[model samples]
Target: MDAAWLNPEEWTCSEGVQEVLLESRKSSTRLTYLAKWTRFSRWASERGISPLRSSIEAVLDYLLHLRNQGLAYSSIRVHLAAISAFHLLIQGQMVFSHDMMVRFLKGLERLFPQDLLKDFLYKREKGELLIQKSKRLKNNLLKQMQLSVSKDGFVHFGDTVMLLSPENNKSPTENYPAACGNLTLAVNPDDITVHTSESLQVPCGLSAVKSVNPVGRNAFRILSVEGNSMGEPIRFGQNFGLGATGGFTDQMLYLASDHKSFMRFAKKSYLQQVFLTDELSYLTCWQATFLDPQLRLEYEGFPVPANTKVLITHCHTNRGLAVPRNYWIRSYFGKEYEVICHTYLDSHKAEEDKNYWIIVTANPSDDGITMFDRPKPPSEETREREKNELYAGT
Candidate 1:
């Protein structure tokens, strides 16, 4: 707004000072740009937009307005140059020289190849194009948390109930593991305790993992199947059985394949009797392993922490357990998504992938060892007792 910066009186300062000042005021076209700056200022002031300190959105809106008024592309650049010079003189920042502004101009060039203004006016008048201002909002950046599970933690065999949590960007009340509006990984119980017999199905997909409506008690039990079965602590990289611990009938989850050549995408999961000495029982065994190198280095062979993301690998198929978020089906428990076992190894992106599952331990007790706890060394009496027990076994 100050024309004093444009025109100057005879300088009586030192020779070097006058020379530097003259160099700074070397723009001969400053007088021509004055009218452009005045027009922008008037337009901005009328629309409640500050000409001195305005956002990128405001600048974009002004450009759109210029295009709508049938201004030539060269004329628009001249106006921008004037605005840039005005901002540099007043605010000490060349706004149009920003990377975003440069990219925007390039994008406009590409989008409108020939007669940018004329084409824009034609399209806009014909109702084929419309420029809508985007509302300014905060970015919802997902945060990551790291934790470790120890041997004596709450992840016990056939006892501890847990929920598979997914990262949610929703509100705090209905977030991860609390699937109020979204699908939750659950098994449909054949026998309904609360509902009458007529309402229930006799032999539904048992232990079948489905992304069903969350019934609050949708949780699974982790059972150790490798060494010291059922009663011992479940460890990472060790074989285990996952059972739907929700309703009247608890079934062990396993991957079932139909001898199809396209088994990678076709292998569906089911719940059945895993402890029985049948050929299909081996499919029930699965292993939990870390997908991250840092996590594996620190927590490998250790008990997997509850509410932490880990890879669930099926022992029989040697494929990772996955829930295809796109595949939806109508189940006895309403609309549900399908779960399958497939090794995501064709691409190097498998190193950090969707195969990761969050296991959230339910009702964690105070006495149970947690991921934060450090293991204490055994005393002399404990060592003597262990030696005596070994000697007796021998």
Candidate 2:
């Protein structure tokens, strides 16, 4: 009966909570609260729970979800506080006012008794957190970070930045602990079949011969697909002087060629979560990897990139091209990422084996790949294909 209950502000993160966030914001509590609230909304939507009408029961379900996701205990308590605060802002009362909420959190404290106030950090399901401190703590942490970097080239800042769920979070190797970015994948080096038969075209109208082979049709798709961050525009199918065509540059072509040589490119796993701490220079290697953003590769039933696309043909053995290849697409962000496909979960590394992901922040490495300039005449095959295509269009 009260129109006040129908107000949109009752369910949104707006002015109502703005002052509260500022008033009680801690080292990074403001960001933590905002992020946790966002995660809450996302979790609610996925399960068909309405923000405006979600009940205490739903709050419990979310907590269970976070626990099932391996979030740290302290992180969970913070999230619990965030949820309670959010509800107070929107609903004008606490859905979690029940003593059980307090009791549950207290119980968790008994189990995971890590001191949140003293512990430098804790990781989360998605983003990372660097709790700023009273200049003293901040300087000490930075010194520690710098020391680690000097010793290890770069340190996987560990166990502090907390995410709501690993299923929903995917950061790169850098944000994790010392064990991330393990170069050796599950594939046996002996199983890596090398094919010395194909040629990879580069932008300079020249080609590089690759070693790995795929039995699948070498049907290539170089159409350059732009992503969130658009670098230099890679023209499709044009000889840009040693770059890839159709967005497929020499690096991509080389990887695809390797896939064909390996007999079944799918058998060998390429590098994932690569991070060279000392090198400021970077390059992204687009090994011929493909992903189905939804069906098999969905993260929490949502596509990881949510913009995954693929192109392939039904010709060739598909083996030469590698039927089910799983290589880390090192080109997306600077971090190497093995696309998580439902179909390949069994073959993927154990949770600890792979890097603790939070999305990539570093640029790609180019030690084994190349992208460039300098003109050369297009191959006769390219010229002929264009000629034939022009005539066919007419």
Over 90-136, each residue of candidate 2 has an lDDT whose tens digit, in order, gives: 33556555666767677766765664433334432221332222222
Residue 347, model 1: lDDT of 52
| Clashes per candidate, residues 3 or more apart or on different chains | 2, 59
RMSD of 2: 25.4
Give per-model TM-scores. 0.39, 0.25
Per-candidate Cα lDDT values, in order, are 0.52, 0.33
Minimal lDDT window, size 10, model 1: 133-142
lDDT of 1 by residue, 238-297 (tens): 877765423323233322332234322331333111121112356567888886755676
Off by over 4 Å in 1: 1-154, 168-183, 188-217, 227-231, 249-280, 293-299, 345-347, 351-353, 363-394
Range of the 10 consecutive residues with the lowest summed lDDT in candidate 2: 184-193
